[model samples]
Target: MNTEVVEEKSTKDRTVVRKALTYFVLIALIFISAIMVVFEVYEYRYDYRQMSSLLRNEDDLNAEWGRLLIEQQTFGATAQIGTRAVTQLRMYSPPPSDTVVISLPSTAQQK
Candidate 1:
């Protein structure tokens, strides 16, 4: 009877230890999962901020590109080129009396 009691007590002690270990492992896993979640949230926020900054930069670049395009068109105009030529290069067009016109015969007429 004494030996049976000792055996039962030992079994109960092992069961208690097992339960404690299981609980500890479960709590540790929960803590680790919580930390991972916090890290993920932080990383997500960081990425979002970076993306927003990139978008703003893209918008600025697009606006600059539009301005550049307008400037290009302004500079490439024929009137602007003619004005530059007259002012900078001292060039001018000849009078109508000095101009000459030549007409070429058509292929059918030649044939």
Candidate 2:
């Protein structure tokens, strides 16, 4: 009877220790998972902010692109270029009597 009691007490102590260890491991896993989730949420918020900033920059760049395109159109107009060329570069249109036409002979015609 004494030996049986000692054996049962030892077995009960081992069972208690096992349950405590299992609970400890379970709590540790839950804590680690919570920390990982928090980190992921933080990272997601950071990336979202960065993406929003980039989108704003893209919008600003698009506006600048539109302005540049308008400027290009204004500068590259034929009448504007011709007027500037005449006024700044002292160019003039030739008279009709000074005009000459040149013709290129086609290879098919020669053949």
Candidate 3:
């Protein structure tokens, strides 16, 4: 009877040690997983911030391009160019005095 009790106590001790080791392993795994998750979250957030800054720069560049296009169109208007071309190139449009009016029969004027 005493030997049986001793064997039972030894088996119980072994079982408790195994349970403790298993819990320790599980806890360590959970801690490592939590650390990895934190690192991934930080990296993702940093990348997102960088992407946001790049997007802002692109928007700024697009806005500048739009503004430049508007300025170009304003300056390149047909009336503006016609004036500049005439004055700067020493060109002109003749007045009515230089125009000649030829009167002919409608049937013969078709050519």
Candidate 4:
């Protein structure tokens, strides 16, 4: 009877120790998983910010490109060219009374 009691007590001790070890392992795994989740969230937020900054830069470049196109059109207009020619180069069109026209003979007539 005494030997049986000792063996039973040892088995109970082993059961308790095994249960404690299992609980420790589970807690450790939970902690590691939580840390990984935090890192993933941080990485996602960082990428989002980078993408937003790139989008804003693209928008600014597009706006600048639009403005440059408008400026080019304004400078290249016929009225703008005529005004610049008159003001800068002092050029003018002749009056109809001072103009003359001439017609040339055709190649067939020459042949």
Candidate 5:
């Protein structure tokens, strides 16, 4: 009878040990999953910051491009060129009486 009692007690102890081990494994899995979630959140925030910086850089470049286009237009205008020539270089258009026309010989005629 004592031997039977000892066997039953050992079986109960084994069952308790198995339950504890199962609970420990489940808790470990939950902790690991929480850590992974935190890591993913950090990565997401980092990517958002980098994207924001790139967008700001793109906006600055676009503004610079607009300025450059405006400068080109100012430089390339015919009126601006004529004004600069007249004022800075003392150039003028000739009167009709002083105008002369000279026609160059054509290549076909020379041949």
Candidate 6:
């Protein structure tokens, strides 16, 4: 009976130690998973911020490009070209005597 009691007590102690280790392992796994989740979230947020910053820069550049295009159009409009053509190049309408019409031949008449 004494031996049986000692054996039973040792077995109970081992079972408690096993349960404790299992709980410790579970807690450790949970902690590691939480840390990994936090790291991923942080990295994602950082990447998002970087992407947003790039998008904002792209927007700014697009706006500047649009402004430049508008300025170019304003400066290169037909009215401005007409003025420059008449003033700088001394261009004028063709006189009636200088007018002529040249017609293209049909495809079958090509050289």
Model 4, which residues run further than 4 Å from truth?
78-111
For candidate 4, lDDT tens digit of each residue in 1-111? 999999999999999999999999999999999999999999999999999999999999999999999988987897888999999999999999999998899999998
Residues 20-110 of candidate 6 have per-residue lDDT tens digits of 9999999999999999999999999999999999999999999999999999899789788899899999999999899998998999998
Per-residue lDDT for 4 in model 3? 100
Which candidate number would show the highest TM-score if scored against the true structure? Answer: 1
Q: What is the Å distance of residue 87 in model 1 from its true position?
A: 18
Q: Kindly list the per-residue Cα lDDT of model 5 for residues 5-105, writing each as its tens digit.
A: 99999999999999999999999999999999999999999999999999999999999999999988987897888989999999999999999999999
Q: Put down candidate 2 lDDT per residue, 86-106, tens digits, no spaces.
A: 999999989999999899999
What is the total number of backbone clashes in candidate 2?
Answer: 0
Candidate 5 wrongly placed segments (more than 4 Å)? 78-111
User: Ten consecutive residues with minimal summed lDDT in candidate 4?
Assistant: 72-81
Cand. 2 Cα-lDDT = 0.97
Higher-lDDT candidate of 3 and 5: 5
Candidate 2: the clashing residue pairs are none
Candidate 2: 10-residue stretch with minimal lDDT: 72-81
- Residue 61 displacement (Å), model 5: 0.8
TM-scores for every predicted model: 0.72, 0.70, 0.62, 0.62, 0.64, 0.64
What C-alpha lDDT values do all the predictions have?
A: 0.97, 0.97, 0.95, 0.97, 0.97, 0.97
